[model samples]
Target: MAVPHLVQAVAETRGLGTDAARYWLELLALTAPDDRLIRELNGWTGKDIDAAATELQQRGLVIEARRRGATRTRFLPGGWMEVSGPDRPMDVWKAPHHLLWEDDRVHGMIPGCPQVVPPAELYLDVWERIRGGDEPGYTELRTTPHRRKRR
Candidate 1:
């Protein structure tokens, strides 16, 4: 399984549970460059911040990159894509809401918040960008050679 920076942080810091940590990761990924800064800015103390940063580094999500004689930690990307539903990729329209209504219910927030739902046209626009047209198709090739069975 791919390790997101915040998932490792959550596991190490012990501040937020998995779900809350995932949510915070998504939110922080939009703005923060690294998990350590995000945790620190969110009020995590010395040991917790250090542990979370160490966890992120250990998980391979955070990496030290050097440029112009300066080293910095940055998320490596890819793992940040948190798909809304099943493990397999699905059409955006077909997938469940990014967060379920039950999440709001448990957290004591308003249920079925329409403001979070983007219009159908937005989904179609994104799909068009991905599919390149209305035609339903995808490329496939068998990479492995067919092995002969031993008698």
Candidate 2:
């Protein structure tokens, strides 16, 4: 899937790469119509805040409002950002080769293949699944039925 135009536009405007833009967009979406106080935040000067607010307005992602003599910024209607990407393999983090168990059960075995496939990739997938807390295998194993079966 091709990356969405909104993602690219935001990335370009914010000077953040596509990946960081994706994260920031998703986070902004959660804020809805709430006004962002850019200047009052720590580590941000008024000039930086004004520049960011101007950029956001120019991009039509946000609108500037004046309330109680203070300028505020909020997302425009239907300005929610979305990101997409082509289906491609991504590198997965894995433990070193030496850390993996030597047992045959830990390695994936293919029928009619004498070689033992290293489980680093598989371990990465399982680790990601567990970290996400929604993997089917992990869920099943967590359920009482699976525990009973194992017992």
In model 2, residue pairs whose N, Cα or C atoms come closer than 3 Å (at least 3 residues apart or on different chains), thus clashing, are 1-86
Alpha-carbon local distance difference test for all models? 0.36, 0.34
Cα displacement (angstroms), candidate 2, residue 79, comes to 10
Whole-model alpha-carbon lDDT for candidate 1? 0.36
User: Model 1, range 1-151, lDDT digits (tens) per residue?
Assistant: 1135535555456454443344234322222223454454455554554565455556543344432211224433222222223222212222233333342121212332222344333333323332454222223555988899999
| Per-candidate total of colliding backbone pairs | 0, 1
How many clashes show up in model 2?
1
Task: Report the error of model 1 at residue 66, Å.
Answer: 3.8
- Residue 11, candidate 2: Cα error in Å is 2.0
Q: Which pairs of residues have clashing backbones in candidate 1?
A: none
lDDT for position 16 in model 2: 54
Q: lDDT score, residue 69, model 2?
A: 21
* Model 1 weakest 10-residue run by lDDT: 104-113
Off by over 4 Å in 2: 1-10, 13-42, 66-71, 78-151
